[model samples]
Target chain A: MTAEIKWVFLYSLLTALATGLGALPFAFLRQVSTRGLALAESLAAGLMLGASFSLIAEGSHYGLTQTLTGGAFGGLLLLAGKRLLDGHDIQFGEIRGAGARRILLILAIMTLHSFSEGIAVGVSFGGGQKLATLITLAIAVHNIPEGLAISAVLRPQGASLLACAGWSIFSSLPQPLMAVPAFLFVETFQPVLPYGLGFAAGAMVLMVFLELLPEAYEKADSENVALWTTLALVAMVLFQTYL
Target chain B: MSSTPILSLLVAASVAALATTLGTIPLSFDLKAKRRALSAAYSVAAGIMIGAGYLLTLAGLESRPSACILGAVLGSTYSFWLRRVTGSKKFDDNDLESIPVEPKEVDRFLLQSSFHSAAEGAAIGAAAAVALPLGLFLAAALAVHNIGEGMVLTHRLYSPQATSSHPNAVPAPLLWPTSLPPAALVVVTKLPQIVLAMGTYFLIQVWPEFLPLALGFTAGALFFLTLTDLTPFAYGQGRREWVALLCSAAAALVVLGQSFFL
Candidate 1:
């Protein structure tokens, strides 16, 4: 209703939309070879690795113990979720079986993490409009790699580029949805921010080791996989540091 | 007064050498026992390395939290480079070229030894630069830690079958140069501590503020070892669930131990 709330919603929506840009690079590739897919997965694993570390670092700015404890719980939760999902045959739209399961899992994780980013955007606004705008832009830029990470997994498994982009945006939908409330109640959201960041980070890190890295290793040479993963991690960390 | 740091470096490096030597003493045992315990040992070592690195990271965070991440990136990048370079085929010439493309346990063990030694040496140097007592404490703790690592290194690298020249016979690469006698293997592996410790000493002397970054670097390197190398190798040994549990338990042990002591 208010102008400030409208702005918050709009900015958050913009951030969510930025995620679709991650899939843009996928357009340049004509076909996906096994090695290319493996490297892509490695890139995703590295991005997740860097993102998780950054999340922990950011959360530690508030409270280290809370962040780490939240990370442990987050990892456990993801593992438990994976176990539960394994019991049922999974289908996500046109995707099915293992591919469908992986898609659903990554989507669930990215969405879960976006909630923290949404709250972050909301909380930044409480500091001032200038701060809010800067944080929103940074997050929007950051979401591109995250989108790429999602598309890396989804596109190779037969999802269309359009579908991948749409799913990427969909995964980030939590930003606008959670931002309004967090902005309205900054005090309430601030305390829980670290835990949420930690949770997202923990789950993402576990997912990299459990899913992406393993798959990368299986499909490609271990040496190449390590190289791609490390390079991607270094790039992501530097990106977060500078941006 | 200025020489105290340099002097402490020698002391720390000497302690590490002694500790590592003691750790490798079990290499003389029968091969089957070592093979059986290999995965379990790696699992425990992985956990301890993570714990120790995390403790160092926490200490670094106390003064400069942000620097830890930068340090971590640098450290992990170093590890990645180390793994890449070491994994190359020309590290040595041996008859094991025809073996099935199983993971190179020899290269992994070599990287683990050198990488960890350098990281721990830097930690010792950085800590000592801050305070002699702190440096000495870390050296002693790491000395104890290196013993376990030494044990793992020897077990993984020194099996009787590894020394043979036949293509069909040698499953793993020989632990040392073929020309070098078996007795020299111990000397060669333990050599990294003195060299890396000296190098780290010079680094700290040049930049006093390198302490936190050094700690961060150590943590990052350790994490790389666990996630990229050890986890997969351990899993390959079979019983994924137990390997995971042991890794977790060892990590918890180090985390808890350091929390109380450090």
Candidate 2:
């Protein structure tokens, strides 16, 4: 059992690490154009949007009301967080003010999202190592795109791709942290799982609307923004659905 | 050993009414804070409503497309007229500090809420009469759904703007209980459907036809309300482009979620 638990933690960590790979594409680009940055943001929006609904759908297995109520609270939390952070002269390394706030907000949102994925990882391990591995691998693959999403928002703000990759992995650190406890107490985690999923979904949805989309629109035309958003959204949903 | 159809209908109607009433509890919370969070919350509510409306439309279309279309048109027209008569304009302010909403608007909003809830109740009663399981599922669904309706109602009708804008508007103490009356109307509207579906022999077949109409009307009203009123208000609260973008994403999310999972 201890061996199994160690494997669960390792596998979950691997998924978290996989996120950094999303920044590789950014490494290849010499300089991102304004339109390119906008498209990247749209892609991130689409991915988050797809993930939010998927989380809602998964959460519905426990109860729709539980999931939705949790979602509402999640929105409240984001709103409250924004209000609290507003007017503060925030600084992180070179990033400061609104840029720091934006990066920090998305990282916070994504990290919160990882908690649910961690729970999934932990809960799956309760089934067995095989189930755990499969779930971990899927999450790991998904995290790559999520990492790219982080880099997309971060790269435009002048963060190095390495830093983008680091932030991307950092956003997913919750998975391993959350997995062990959930695995240890699957029964206890069962009821509250939907709420966690819903909370993440709610926060991500609000972030996309309140933060990411507006920034994307600033750099490009509505048609371009909509086009990339729709395309990426459709792609992400398909990816998750099939996988 | 099995319960009668009438018994199930009564139980369903009661449960739905109770659920709706419970939903209004949030109205009791202190909404004194004037912030963009209120609008964000409203946008979130609109997203949920839009998802519900989309699902309802799909379900109605599955049964009767023509009826759904006709009901949608009527529902949209009803909403339009309600807004027009009340002279409700979009809240152009930065936050919930002050809304230009009038007292009559709240009344109209409540009227629409009752109408939608009544439709839901009728659907529950009709479904219950069809089969025990189907009825139970729908009743349970609507019971959950009405909570959201209750919240949306309180959020819009009892918003800080509604009270602050008009000094004579419904007070919190008096208006808090108003949530119950609309809930009670659910049972009232449900009783006839229960009687018609269970009491008369031939009316059971007829009741199914009304399902599409009811669902369509609810969906149409929700679509109109979310798009025209709620989404616009959300846009005015802050960045318009983001609201439009996220709103579309939300719609897509609902579409994908419903298609894949539900």
Tens-digit lDDT track for model 1 on A162-214? 99899999999999999999999999999999899988987886677567766
In terms of docking quality, model 2 is incorrect
Worst 10 residues of 1 chain A by lDDT: A222-231
Clashing pairs in 2: none
lDDT of each: 0.70, 0.65
DockQ of 2: 0.05
Worst 10 residues of 1 chain B by lDDT: B92-101
> For model 1, what is the C-alpha lDDT against the true structure?
0.70
TM-score of 2: 0.56
Candidate 2 error regions (>4 Å): B1-262
Compose the digit string of candidate 2's lDDT tens values, residues B141-215: 556555644554545545556557666554333223434444453334334433332432134345656766665
Give the distance in Å from residue A101's predicted Cα in candidate 1 to where it truly belongs.
2.8
Compute the lDDT of residue A141 as modeled in candidate 1. Answer: 89
What is candidate 1's TM-score against the reference? 0.77
